[model samples]
Target: MPKTIDDLSTPCLLIEKERLEANCRQMQARARAEGVALRPHTKTHKMLSLAALQKSHGARGITVAKVGEAEVFAAAGFDDICIAYTVVGAEKSARIAALAPGISFCIDSLEGARQASAVFAGLGRTVRVLLEIDAGYGRCGRTWDDPSLVTFARHVADLPGLALGGILTHEGNAYQPHQAATVMAEARDRMLSVAVRLGDAGLATRGRFVISVGSTPSANVFRNAHRDGFSITEIRPGNYVFNDLTQVNLGVCSFKQCALTVLTTVVSQHRGAGGAVRFFLDAGRKVLTSDRAPLSDTYGQLLYHARTMAPHPHARLTNLSEEHGWGAVRGGSTLTVGDRVRIVPNHACVVVNTQDEAYLVDGDEVLNTWRVDARGHVQ
Candidate 1:
C-alpha cells in the first residue's frame, strides 16, 4: 500500500524516517569519537520505536524525565534506564524504585536522598543515584561550589537502598550558539571539580558513567571535553532526535536536520479591506504548540507543500487560537483554502507529546505510524 501525507489527517505529527536516522547516527558517531556513552534523553518523542532506534545506534542506555516514562521504557525491555529528573516523594519513589537495580536517577539534596532511602528500603531494591549540580540552569540542583554537595554525596553513599553514582548537570544556559563552547567547557570543569571533591571526601562513586551532562545545544561540549582529556563519560541530548526551530536558532543543528513536523491545512483564508492576506490553518496552539524559538516570533515554520518541502520565507504564523493557526504574508499567497502544509515546530519535545501517534515518512511517502508509547507519562 502506498501511503502519503495527504491520506493522513490534519494537525498530526510527522517524523521523517531518513532525517531521524541520520540525526541518531550523527550523535552516535560523536559519542563514539569522544569515547562517551550516548544515553539519549527519550523525553523528546517518548515512543518505544524511537527509543529502540536510538538504542540500535549504540545508545548504551536511555534517559527519561519522569518515573512513568522510566516504567514505560523499562517494561519494554530497556534494561539500562535513568530518570534524568529527580524522583522524590513516596509515590514517585516507589514507582521508580520498582524499576531498579536496572534504573538510576538524579537527586539534588540530602532531603530527597533521605526520602529515597526510606522509600527504596521498603521496596527492597537498591537504586543508583547521581547528585545533580547546577550549571546556570537554576531549575534544579545545587551550585557546583555549594558546601551541601559533599553532604548530599556522603548521605547517598551511606543511605540504604541507594548507591552514589556520580555528579550530573544540565547546562541549559549553554544553548547560545556562539557561547556554548565556553559555557559548557566551564560547566564541565566545575562538574569535574565537584567530582574530585566528592572523591577527596572518600565517597565511593560506583556508576561507570558518572560525570554526565545533558542538553542538545551542549552536545559537542561533551565531545570536546572528552577529546581534551576531561573525563565526561556520558551525554543525554534529547531534542537531537527531532531537531526543531530552537535547535536551528541555537545553531546546534541545521534546518535540514529537523525531522519532525506537523501536517496542517489552510482551513480558511481572508483578504483584508487594505489588501493584506490572511490564512487560518487547521493546526493551532494545541498541535503546533506556542513554543517559539529564540528571536523567532512564530510558533512554527511553514512549508508551502509537503512534496515541495520548501519553507515559505514570507508567510508568518502570527497567532494561534485553540483550533486555528492565523498566519499572514505581506503579499498575496498563491495558496487558497484547503491547501495542505507542513510545519517545523519550535519544540519537537513538547510537540510530539501532543499527538498519540506520528506518521513515519520518507520524503512524503508514509511508511508507518508509531504509537507515542510514553506520551503523557509525566508522573
Candidate 2:
C-alpha cells in the first residue's frame, strides 16, 4: 500500500495538486489568448498524469529535450511529441526514426537531417523535423541569419523521407538577466525576428512555418511580443508547471504559487557565539542537485516553517554539502531536532531528475505517488 503524505518518510519531494492545476490553467489560457498552441515541455514534471492535465487544458503537444524523454512520454500515450534538442548520431538517428511514426523531432544540422531522411526512408516513413535556429543562445542551434540556414532547410525539404515542419529555438540566454519581464520580452522578439526573416526569404511555404520558442523566462514575457508577423504556431514552456526558487528569485512567480517542494526533517540544532542559532536538515546536495548555474548561488531555499505553514521572511539556506543543508534562522524562533520543514529547490528540473518518484499532496494528505518516468535518461 502507498503511504499517505503525513505518514511518508521525511525529505521527500511533494507536489501540491491544486496549485499545479492552477498553474497549468493560467499558462493554457495565456497561450490561447495569444493564438499560439501550447506545447509545454514535459522535461519539468516527467509524469504521465501531469502531461495529461496539460493536454486536457488544450495543449497541442508535449516537448522534450532528449530522445529518451520522448520515448517515455510516447509510451505513456502522448503520441504527438517534439524532441526539442538537436538530433545527432547513428544510434540516436535510428531511435528517432523508430519514433518518427509517432513523434516529431527537431534538426539543426545538414548531416542530422540527411541521416534522419536516410533512416526513415528504409522504414518507408518521412520524419517531421523542425529547423532549430540560434536565437543568440550560442547553444546547439544554428545561426538564424546564417546563409546556410536556407540551404539546410531546402536540403531537409528535398530529402525523400523528411518533412520540414518549421523552426525552433530555446531562448535560454534570457534567464541570465535574472529579470523575468526583461528576459521574456527579449526572448520573444529574438525568436519572432528569426521567424520573420525566414518567412521573408520564401523559406516558409504553404503556411508550414512553425515558429516555436520556449524557456520559462521567455514564456513569462511572450505577451509583449508582436503576434501577427511571425508564424509562431506553438509556444513551449515547461517550468511553469512547477515554479521553483529560481523562478521566484527571477520574479517569474511568487512563493505561494510554487507547487513543488522538498520536505525535510531537522536533524540538528545548535547555538553559536553571540547567541546565533543554526539548524541542519537531513536533505542535502544528493537529494537536491548541487548543479548551480552561473546566476544562482545556493542549492535551495527554506520555505519558512513547514509545520505551522508560516512564511519565513528572513530564513535562508546558509550552506550545503554532500548530505546536509546548514540553515541559519535570523529571528528568535526555537527549532528542535526532528522538526519537519519544506525546501524550495533552486532548480525544480534538476531536483526532479534526481528522484525516481514524487508524492502528490493536498494540504497534508498524500493522494498518490507519481513516478519520475523520464528521470536519468541523460543521453
Candidate 3:
C-alpha cells in the first residue's frame, strides 16, 4: 500500500490529477466550440479512471486502436466506443460480435470488411464501420488521395452487415512543424474529396457519414477546420490528455500540461568522460519504453535536483538498456545516488501500456492508485 507519492517504488507511472483534468476539459471544450464531437483515443493512458474523467468532461465517445481495448472499455460501461483499427482474425471478429449493434470500428480493405460482414450477418448483427484513410502515415488504410477510395467506400456500404458510419484518419506522421501544416491540409482536401464523392454516389453523405481526424499535434487544425465549416464531425486526439515530451517538442502542449510521468530514483552517479556528471536512473527501456521525440535521439528529460516537477537545466537521457538509463549533465556534480526524480517520456502512450497500474498524484500525495484496465490489449 503506497500511501503517498514518495512511498511508491521507483520506475512506476504517475498521473497528476489536476493537470489531467485540465487537459481533458480543454480538449472537450475545443471540440465542443468547434461543433464536433470529442472522441478521445484511450490507447494513450489505457486507464479506465482517466477514460471516465474524459467522459465526464463531455467526450461524446471513446476511441481504441484494437478490438481488445474496445472490449475492456465496453465491459467497463462505455456504451459508445469506436475500435479505430482495422481488426483481423476470427477471434477478433467474434469478439466484435459481442460488442455489436452500437460498436463502431475502422477498416481499409474490402476483404477485411467482407470477413466482418460474414460474421456479423451470421449473428444477425450490423456494426457501424468507418473507412480509414491513411493521411501520410503509411501504416494502414488506403491513402487519402487514393483514386479508388470512393468506389471502395461504396463497396463497404453495400456489405450486408456493415453500416457505413464515417471516414477517419490518424495524422501520426504530422509530428514536426514542417509536416503538421502540409499533412493537415492534405487530410482536409483529400477527405473532403472522398466524402463528397461518396455523397455523390448516394451511398453516404456529409449529413450522414462522419468525417473525423485525429493527432494531438494537429489538434488546433482539427478545431479550426471544423469551425470553418469543414466536413469534419469528430476529432480523436488521444495523447492530448497526457501531453508527453513528444507533444512538448512539437509545440502542441507545454510541459506543465503534461499529466503523466515516470517516477524513478538515481541509483548511481559518477564523473564520466570529459569530467561531466553522469548518472544511472533506475528507469530504462522497460519503464520509459524508449520512444524518442520525432526525428530526434533524445530519449527523455529528467526533473533534476530532487525536484520531481522541475525539469533539469540540461540533463537528458541519451541512452537506455533494459533496466538502466544513461544520463549526463554539464557542470552538475551535486546529483547523488538515491535522489528521487520524475521523467517525462518522449511518448506517453507506450509508457502507460508498460505499467500494470499508475498512481494518481496531486503534489506529493497519492490521490488514488488505478489499474491500467485497458493496457496490453493489442489484439
| Superposed model 2: Cα runs more than 4 Å off | 1-4, 178-186, 200-202, 224-229, 272-275, 292-298
lDDT digits (tens) for residues 1-379 of candidate 3 = 7778778888898888999999988888888877788999999988889899888899998999888888898888888888888876556788988873568888888888998889888888888889988867788888877778878888988998889988888887778656676777777667777677777777665456788888887775663453223377888999998998888877777888988888888899987887778999999899888677865566886776434587787787889999998887766856788887888899999998889999988878888999999777887
lDDT of 2 by residue, 1-379 (tens): 3455558787789998888999999998888887789999989988888898889989998998898988888777788899898888768878876663657778887788777877888778888788888777788888867767666777778897888778888877767755555655665676667666666667665346778888877787677445446546788989999988878777778877889999988898888778889888898888887756335555677766674444466666778887888888777546689888888888888888878889988878888888998887767
Compose the digit string of candidate 1's lDDT tens values, residues 246-300.
8888878777898998889889898866888898999998888788788788888
Q: Against the unseen true structure, what C-alpha lDDT does each candidate score?
A: 0.84, 0.79, 0.82
Error of 2 at 82 (Å): 0.2
Model 2 weakest lDDT span, ten residues long: 223-232
**What TM-score quantifies how close candidate 3 is to the native fold?**
0.95
lDDT of 1 at 322: 87
Candidate 2 residue 120 Cα shift, in angstroms, is 1.2
The per-candidate count of clashes, in order, stands at 0, 0, 0
**Global Cα RMSD, each model:** 2.0, 2.4, 2.0
Model 1 misplaced stretches (Cα beyond 4 Å)? 204-209, 224-230
RMSD of 3: 2.0
For this target, which candidate reaches the highest lDDT against the unseen true structure?
A: 1
| Better TM-score candidate (2, 3) | 3
